[model samples]
Target: MNAGPISATAAATRAAARQLLRIVIVGHVDHGKSTLVGRLFHDTGSLPDGKFEAIRKMCERRGMPFEWAFLMDAMQAERDQGITIDTAQIWFKTEKRDYTIIDAPGHKEFLKNMITGAAQSDAAVLVIDATEGVQEQSRRHGYLLHLLGVRQIAVAVNKMDAVGYREDVFTKIEAEYRDYLASIGVTPTFVVPVSAREGDNIATRSQAMEWYDGPTVVGALDSFQLPATSVDRPLRFPIQDVYKFDDRRILAGRIESGRLHVGDELMFSPSNNTARVKSIEVWPEPSDSDARPNTVGAGQCIGITLDDQLFVERGEMASHTTNPPVETEVFRAKLFWLGRKPLEKGKIYKMKIGTGEAQVTVQEIEHVLDTTDLSSSTTSKVERNQVGEVVLRSRRMLALDEHTRNGRTGRFVLIDGYDIAGGGIISMEGYADQRQLVTQRAKNITRVQHGVPTDERERQNGHKGGVLWFTGLSGAGKSTLATKLERALFDRGYQTYVLDGDNIRFGLNANLGFSPEERAENIRRVGEVAALFSRAGLLTITAFISPYQSDRERARKAAGEHFHEVYIKADLGTCEERDPKGLYAKARTGEIKDFTGISAPYEAPDTAELIIDTSNLSIDQALEELLGYVEKTFRS
Candidate 1:
């Protein structure tokens, strides 16, 4: 059993190298992520000869005429702007071990970058300037990291040299920051005090701080362990893309499960596609069984080229042979509504889950959460940057996994009109049952129709009949324009029927009114009716103060290209003046509540092909332009 004794430093380095830690360094500008890294290289002798000089020459070429803070920043934007924009991964090693450091930006506008960094990290080393203590962005990053389930955290009290290497100062700052972290359910695992500028305690203990007796920045970082990955849970490799080389087709993916090997049976989910693992191609060489699974798991950058290319696409995920994934029609989610407009219930927005996208509506805002405090609010509407718990009702349910268990299938983003409005993880699941409920509830509703039939309707009319959905405030003259349009179209031999809210309430939609839910249902029913009539090829003109954008979008989906939208745009004051039904008058007097033109909210569409201002467009002119657009729409 006699063996050669290894040196203590060698033993420590081996132990550190074995620990697979994924670290993200996050801090405000000038707080020193790059500087700390720079110091780490210098003190540990990682910097080769002429490397410092190389960076110095680069700085000189850029004409900074001073020491460069962006040498280690790496990114061109980071080098030029002197700020990290997103989380960039860099590998470094000390005599004690290796570290995967993710450098993240601090700018408020770059929250997406921060999200990406936090999402990929196991533990975070938050750099806090000793002079500033904790600021708003610091709090925000901390909160987001906590939400992301980053358990272990390290707080580097940097720039201590500027304050005379004050131990008492750092102690006070640490206590204050810890209390705030506690409020958000996070307790940092380690706090290392160092001056990234002076190189004190970064790689070496500061002789300046005899009062301080704790781990150096290098020791603290070396000690931190990579958070345990969820390999035992389930395999979830999101298919980045499939590749074809000659005759071989490889479904490229990263392993998010128990070790996958050659000839292993695997199944692709959501698509319900399956394929066998011909070989897992990881280069420069595939992982051997002798290596632990932690070395290769979710979030690790490796590609798996399967035996056969099975139509795998980005956003799709692969699972194991036995435990298959479930598909559903609806699911509960915690959404961060980052859209400019408030999230409207029963409005269909495109939801992007992994690679799969579907039309979904906020079925119910169970409760909106206060972003600043993370507390529940009774308010039904959630605005920009507000994170809330929402129950979404989708047109079609996609397969999903609980976010806590799986990151791949669990996360999704919402697209409003053309922009990505929001994104978040799947906090809850089981939407198929809700789909059944929604379908069952719709069965009791009876149908109503306008006189003209399909082929006869379109043949008699020059073009197919469709609803030109016009939405604006009550005074916006939706009905007036609709009536004018009907008269003109009729004169032109187009068999058209104008469906106004006043007339519909008198007949079909009389049961509903201005409450958010009621208004949504009314619009939904009308949108459906209009689509049906248009499909039959008749010119169906419908006008209402359908203030919700989601409702309008749903109407478009229901009608397809046959769906014509007209936003009767007008000023609130002009609309108030033109109030035909005296609805706005009554709302202003507070006699009527939850009114569309008064108390209720309106989400204007980001992209509307036609925008008509009734204040400027006389009934004659508005009708002329609208009919013109509609005439061309069908022809196109």
Candidate 2:
């Protein structure tokens, strides 16, 4: 028997089956992203036989010079237009490991395609023309890479031959771009000067520039470390479907991370259902008597039967009891919009994360980012091809992880009328994981009804007892209004009290801190206390910067009909200028963490019973309106 020679594509595929790293090359249009990729394959002898010759012969017949970029721009339209309009993927190898280089388009109109490539890459190569230096698209691509959480980067200063291979030219571009990246919290691993078209300093060092001494482009790529394997991370098996074979109910899904074993305890998230894995099931059972497997790791598709008949369904994630995904109804996302129409607040869109899909509403657009200059401005909507920080709300809780923690379950896409309009990475920065809060731990509890009637208490006090919950930024004057209103009610022969945020923290909520979880717990405890005070025939006023809308909703649920939300409205500028306690200054200077209207978010009420704009009205005028409303509504 004779063994046949393997084809280049087959050989590359076999090599790719081993350890591989994904790298996406991006830059401004005509900056040579595709050219660098093509030169890399040619220099490394990674191209198939006759592939280069065919391209060169075609260019000769067409009366055009042979272009290195033609090796990557395979599409006829791209070659005709002299620009890459889509992402192109190819496989090559270095002595160290196999590589999948993604050539993403550099044209501004094709940014969505660029984002698609960058999202799937483990690292990135940013190309810039040595003669042109940095351009608008260069900064935009750099910012997008950082937004997608690609930290390992190498900047390739291509077209160095056009600039005569001057070391000073490369240094100037390096310093300027490095500072820009650092401002956005990214540090490139290396910046190498190369002329991809001339094949200088790509695979080998450039001999033309004797003043420069640094690693070649290949060296920079080889230096990037591979990300930690998924198997070593926590388990996250999203239930894709359920199959009933004979009498066994099998839960089917792929192991996105970690490992699972037979008899291990599993907890399904967003539902909080628990059961033990009865058996690890696989098709075509092992023929050998002792060949049955009992465990599975990341990237394997398998099914398992649970000991108990739990009502598990698709969209629920299975994980070990110790480390589960965060369960929440609202979360923050850094999203890139690609829809022709802008993404507006209060509009509902379908979100797909892992195997789960849910309808999510755009709660707020934090800010629309200017990728070219890295400046952020408040906007009502996110325009096409723009990146923005957004808050999304779902009616039901969803199981997910922050992108920084686990990339597999942390990313999602938005579908609008059957089109992928946007995509983003999840972040729970200013929100709490509501798993513990939603779980009712008490085994036996009963409500005790009050003996006294509310009408009798109101007759005795000459007014109805209720809670006036004032919510706003810290310097919006919630505390001042609450204290003054309490005094006015007392002088008018009404039983009244004020629960200031600072005063409550000193005693009742002494154990609570300013963390998202602690802040939620603090609001929960105060809501219950304020409700009790209302039931006792005293007008209770609460002054707290309850920044989260969900937290305020919980408080409203606690008080029911006796609650009246009062919104103290003031712009961020006005509050900062007032700076009663100088807290905003401290927050800007990094002295305070998670400070509302500064480092943290402040969710204003959309259904407040009364809205007082403190910026426009004096304290006396605002108080008069507040007093009139209370007197007209609460007087018996």
Candidate 3:
């Protein structure tokens, strides 16, 4: 293919409108990643004037073979060491599209830089030495491609000339590497045999290897498909900053995914704040006669002004409320550890995801994978360069989606003091609000055990340590009976405390809401608090309308064996007719959503230590039966 000259204006216009694809070349060190990229650049005629000839002259003057790797090894240190130390990007164009070839360092010492380069790419080209077959870094980089969600990949079995360009040798290496890639859940698009230094099977097919036939490197790159983007998906604009220009406040950011338009309502996650897009603001102010675009889609950097002027800042995501991002403080992630120290449980570290930064702790190490063999290994802490699955607990809730659903929001990086220690993807969401305390046993945090045991405290207090958890629908007389039982236990000279649902909501659970998840969180918080009181050697009476059996079970687990689940039974009709707090009527009128026994589900306990028929039995009779069970259990 021959090329034609172009004016500066035409080139700029072509660059702006051309289909752009980011392609990163990765492999083991001294296996020709830089040479492959340099060869591609030279064959495509993408180099500037006299650049290639200048490198050849430099190589000749230094009494060395005129190597193609010199074009990409631009740094003095990399040239001195004869290795790629950092990721370098160069622009090239095929007949199909424009390309930014990212030459990633294959050396293990620069693995972090390689990760950064691969994360930014849309597709990847993995290189392997044909004679070496498959090295350690080959499997490691392939595993990382799977971890980072780079599905479009092509393998170039380079250095085939060293093995005499034999078809049998290429076939053996290709089969072995294919199996390794499949083990890590990656199916390469093309595995082409090539000698990058000799410029064979790169831009064009090599006549020397006539028996082996496949698309050249350039053909494989062009064959990779481009994904279409539209505004149909949920909006996820991570706020970069809030700019104030001449008294006008605008939120400035690049739409990572989805779309934004004038008058579209957006909800900022973690904060759960809502606002309307008043206008789509852009830079380099248009003339008075010029018209502006009404909407903007993904990858566009634009400033937007909200309908209501409020103090909205960075680190918050702009998303639609109908499809809001999941907000949680805990999630399961797979990360590549690059820290100098092993990642320890309960050790605090700063995590940066999108625009949000928070203190996070490695709560649990599920398992670590040996990247070379793709085998699972048990480890208490994740050492440097090892890929591990872990449970992380952030100090604040973050808005995120699973990587399979949204790559932009699902990814994060851990910063250790001054450097990026690790980077990973969120594979799954977890219950965060109060269930975190349940993992306290697995975390490495210290728990002070005093000289006085709970047995001694209970003996001195004249009662056994336990939590009596009352679960039922609203207006089921759970709170009333719990309070009455507390007084009876107190009068009997027993240590007891009552935790009412509404009372705790005003203090400990003030931030919680009526959503199903929030309600679960509410129950979780009360469960932990009740467990604390029980540990303090008190008979803790918790009266809550915890309608979910799963949540109730978690509460029981958090409170331990001393916890007893008591069902306060009352039919919805009977509770509605009572209307003690006017809650049922409001629930029926649709004034409140997710109201238990009405809008939402109410899961009754299958087995309870005690059941009170509050509908049939009077308040006094119910209190007497509950107090009877409590006294028998605690005072025994």
Which candidate has the top score in TM-score? 2
User: If scored against the real structure, what TM-score would every candidate get?
Assistant: 0.57, 0.89, 0.71
Model 3 residue 186 CA deviation in Å: 0.9
Deviation from native of the Cα of residue 616 in model 2, angstroms: 4.7
Off by more than 4 A, model 3: 1-15, 230-232, 287-292, 429-636
lDDT per residue as tens, model 2, 189-210: 9999999989999998889876
Among all windows of 10 consecutive residues in model 3, the one with the lowest summed lDDT is 430-439
* Tens-digit lDDT string for candidate 1 (1-636): 111123545544553546546688887777887788777766776654566777778878878754435546666777777777766665556765566667787766777677777777778888899988877767766777776677788888898988888889999988977887898789988788888878888888889887878788778887777555566667667676767666667666565554555566777656666677655555455366434222355544456656665677775767775765545555667766768788877677898866567788776676776534557786668877566677775665466777776665677888888988877777543222221212333346776775756666555656766678888887787888888888877787776787788777777878876555567667778888888777777688888888766568778898988787788898888978877778788888899886764565555556777899888878778878887886677532
* Candidate 1: residue 482 lDDT (0-100): 84
Residue pair clashes in candidate 3: none
Model 1 scores what on Cα lDDT?
0.71
**Distance from true location, Cα of 293 in model 3, Å:** 3.7
Going through the candidates in order, what is the number of backbone clashes in each? 9, 0, 0
Candidate 1 vs 2: which has more TM-score? 2
lDDT of each: 0.71, 0.90, 0.84
Q: By summed lDDT, which 10 consecutive residues of candidate 1 come out lowest?
A: 430-439
